[model samples]
Target: ISLIKKEIETFISSYNKSLQQKDKNIKISDIKIQKNTLSLNINSQGIFRPHNALLQLKNSISKEFGKKHKLGVREIKINNYDIQFDLEKKPLKNVTIPFADVKFKEKQATISLNNIDEEFLQKNYIDRMINLVNEKVENQYYEGKGEFWKLIWESGEKKPIWTKDPTEEMTKLDWLKQGPTKGKWFFRPQATAILKTMEKIAVEEVLKPLRFQEIIESNLVPFDIWLKTGHLEGMPGEFYYISEPATRDVEKWERFVDLIKITKEVPLEELEKNISTPAAGICYAQCPVIYWSFKGKTISEKSLPVLVYDNTAVSGRYESGGRHGIERVDEFHR
Candidate 1:
């Protein structure tokens, strides 16, 4: 069965040969497998067919093996990449009922792959190519400027009943002459971080249709991309992400502008230790900065707040054709 899936991939690649002839430069990369399933996305392809092409491949597998299976479901966005699949295996003896032989009911699609002969469709439809590629699509978007989202500060200050042991001995000094530079700690409530974080990588959706589509579309793989911006307590929401991208990876940034490259993942601990301590010999405690480390990504303050470091990751793919995506540990994490 695994071999069949791989073959389905080879078959799809072979099938896509005609796409290039049409002057369509569709590219597919990234291949993944999970128990009884496989998935990927699409990028750069003029035609969106990962979901559709794979189903045909799956249907072919079903016909040759006398097995019953069905197509998977998918969600497509601007790039048109999505998730798609087939039904689980079951015994043919269950065909005794009217809706008996149906292997699975995915998204309300009554699909039967293996036993339904193509010859039958031709016999009934008068030589017409009878294939049903169906999917439901919805458009949901948020309003913003050039950057999909924005982060702004609100008037959230530290609660009057502050809890964390804070410093407060108003040091009366001539430094007040510097005005804003004086140590005036305005207890800030967690302000929203603007699309502060992003993870790059080769397109994972490459696996989505690679197993079944003759022509894999999409040259880029995008997953769990994180976007954080500044926000205030009671102000109009400051930040929102179109997609809940996973954690960030440092390796991916070693080279941006490239998307097809692959990189090895390092332990969150190793990533943390690699930080080249203050080239200027300054710590957050001494410079009115923020110092913290958790999960993997670390933020060491200097003049401005910076990520400084990140650890958890999957594969860092980028859009530049060489490197991409951040290293992600879990679909959601630090």
Candidate 2:
């Protein structure tokens, strides 16, 4: 312990001499040693570059001591970057951030970023990660043959249905009309008839033959359900979300009604203010709720293969730019 203390003192004295030459305003004072730990107060009159200076000092100590010591700071100040954090507790301690400059406050932190090579980060990290993900997706999901997907098994076969072209009359039928937003369409009778026929064939011929029972799922599912089903993470920004009114109080509704009566339209700001955080999302895939239905229920081995399918209620998606004819509409039934 005495040797350690003497070594720390010697390093501190050397470091202080360097600081004296370069930054006379910054000084370490009130150095105390207790149980293999050295505590020192840094006084720089708020003008010192806290993060860089502290990191440098810590690195220097590590280099000198060779992992015999570690640096733990109580607080630090940072600049040049905006960082926000929410803490439910006070008197934060033992905070550690690697390769970052940080200023610590009660509930927030500010960070100063060091110069980085953007091209290197893009090429080495981002692009490499994307390429790895694409490789996995192509190898497993797209290229692999599935038991249920007939297209993969029959890809080499030259079927008459595959060569059929749309009739000129069918092409000119104007079977689809644009809806209120992009990626939405109104199907005309001709289109609806074809869709209904397809649905009938799918249910009557394909599903019913396989003893698959029909199940109708709700159009709006809670966000919690989506989270559990992995859709919230997997399909981010792909589904349409919905929220309840901010207040359920009768007085609030009455006030809203009065304002609506006066304006003959919902006040935009008020409307926005009244909408709460997303409580639910419009069903993107009909099967998420179906999986959720089986939660917490133990199915016997006798009920081993439970098959069900949904063919009602249009699922909603926010197709940013990939909208085409009746085939790829945002509001679609499956």
- Model 1, which residues run further than 4 Å from truth? 3-6, 18-23, 47-51, 54-334
- How far off is model 2, as Cα RMSD? 14.5
Local accuracy of candidate 2 as per-residue lDDT tens digits, 1-334: 3457877888888887787677787787677778755656565533453334555676687677765654433323322323333333342342334444545476444433454333323334433333333343334443446556354453565658644333323447777667667776666799778879988999899999999998888889898998888888677899888888888887767767788899898877777776798889888888888889999999999997999988775799887776666666788876
Worst 10 residues of 1 by lDDT: 281-290
Report the Cα lDDT for candidate 2: 0.65
Query: How accurate locally is residue 291 in candidate 1, as Cα lDDT from 0 to 100?
Result: 21
Model-by-model lDDT, in order?
Answer: 0.31, 0.65
What TM-score do all the candidates reach, one by one? 0.19, 0.52
TM-score of 1: 0.19
What digit string (tens of lDDT, one per residue) describes model 1 on residues 1-334? 3545766567456645544465365544454455555444333345544444444545554564454334332322122222233323222222222211232233322332233333433343211111212211111122232556566866867667755322222223211121131221222222112112221211224332343212212211222112111111121231211222132566643443132244454444443444433212111111111121232554466533332322222121112232211121112122
Best by lDDT: 2
Error of 2 at 219 (Å): 0.9
